[model samples]
Target: MGLKYKYESTSRRDTKELARNVRPGDRLYVIHDVSQVVAPLEDAQLYSEFIVTKDKAPFTGTPMVCSASAHRQVGGTSVTSLLVRYGEVYTERPVGIRNIAEEPPLLPEFQHLAARVAREHAADVAVARSEAASSGRRRWF
Candidate 1:
C-alpha cells in the first residue's frame, strides 16, 4: 500500500487541533501553499482517498510548511469533521501534491554540534596521550 493523504485548507487553530491528535511517532507530511493540507503516513494498507478539492500550486524548493512528526489517533473520516475538532471552519483546499523527505534536513545548528563534539573528543584523546607519555606507562587500546 502506498501512502494515503487527506487534503484540506487549515487555519492556525485547525493546525493546532491536528497537531494535538498526533501521537509520538506518526509522520505528518504538510504541503503548504495559499492553502495547506496534511497527510498522515499511518496504516497505508487501509488507506482511502479523500477528494475535497482540485487545485495546484507552484513547486518551490520546500513544499512543507508544518509537520506533526509523530503518529496520531484522530477521530474522524472527513476533512470537515477532522478540522472541526477545534471549531475551525474548513475553507482551504489542497493545492497540489509533492514528495516530502523521510528525514529532516541537517540544519546548521546540528552541524555545528557535530563539529564541536568531534573537536572535544580529539582534545580529550590528546590529553590522555600526553599524560600517558609523561608517566612511565604507555598503553594503546
Candidate 2:
C-alpha cells in the first residue's frame, strides 16, 4: 500500500481539556516528522557527497562552525542538518526506502505512561474518544 499522510487539527480548548484530564503517568504520544515539514538540504547534500565522493566538505570537517554559518545564511537552524553534516560516517548500509507506516509503536516509557493515564482517566477517555469520533476527523489510519 502507498503511504498516506494523516493530518490532525486540535483546538486550544480541546488541548487544554486533554491536558487537564491527563494524570502523571498518562501515556502521551507526540507524533511528528520534522523532515516531512522541513528539508535538511545542506546536510543531505553534505552527506551524499562525503559518502559517495570520499571527500569531506569544509562544513563536514568543522560542523559546529559550519552549522552556525549555515543557519545564519538559511535563516534557521536544524538539528537534522547539523547531524548529517557533522556526524561520524556509518559503516552500515542504508535501508531501502518504504512506505511510511501507520500507528508506529510508542516508546516503552510512553506506553507505560499512556496505560496509566488511560486507566486513571477512563471516563475522560470515553469523553475524549467520543469527541474525537464525533468531530469528523479525516482518518488516514
Candidate 3:
C-alpha cells in the first residue's frame, strides 16, 4: 500500500518539491534571535560550555534534516544537531555527528522531551521493520 499525499494545494506541492530538491551539501544556517546551546554526545568527554554563536561561526551543517536539524561529520564521528522548536538546536559540542539516541540537556524544561524523543525513535524503528517484513512473502506450514 502507498501513503496518500495531499497535493490539494499548489503551495504545498511546491514546498514538497523544494524540500525534495535540497542537496546534502547545501548550507542552511540555523539562526535565532539569540544564541543557542549545543549538547554533546556521550563519551565526548567534553565540557558543556559550547554555544552556537549568533554573530560568527553559527551552527551550520549539511542538509540532512530529520532526526537532527542539521548534520556534520567531525573527527570521523557522526555529529548530528537536533533543532526542534524555535532556537532549540543540539550540537555535538565541537564537531562530529551527534547521536540523537543520547539524552537531551539536563535542564528541567527539556528533561520532559527526552522521553518523547526516545519513544518517537522507537516507533520509527518499529514501523520501518514492519514495513520491511510486510514486503516479504509469508510462509505457512
Which is superior by lDDT, 1 or 3? 1
How many backbone collisions does model 2 have? 3
Tens-digit lDDT track of model 1 for 8-101: 3455544444433333333333332322234343222121122222121233211121222224333223333434432332222223333332
* Model 2: how far residue 37 lies from native, Å: 10
Using lDDT as the measure, name the better of candidate 2 and candidate 3: 3
Error of 2 at 76 (Å): 34
User: What is candidate 1's TM-score against the reference?
Assistant: 0.26
Candidate 3, 43-136: lDDT as tens digits: 4332222222222113443234432232532222111322222222222233543333445457676678987998998998777777777989
Best by TM-score: 1
Error of 1 at 43 (Å): 18
Ranking by lDDT: 1, 3, 2
User: Can you give the lDDT of residue 51 in candidate 2?
Assistant: 16
Residue clash pairs of candidate 3: 78-97, 79-96, 79-97, 79-98, 80-97, 80-98
Q: How far is 105's C-alpha from truth in model 1 (Å)?
A: 6.6
Question: For each candidate, what TM-score against the reference?
Answer: 0.26, 0.21, 0.25
- Which stretches of candidate 3 lie above 4 Å from their native place? 1-105, 137-141
Say which prediction, candidate 1 or candidate 2, comes out ahead on lDDT: 1
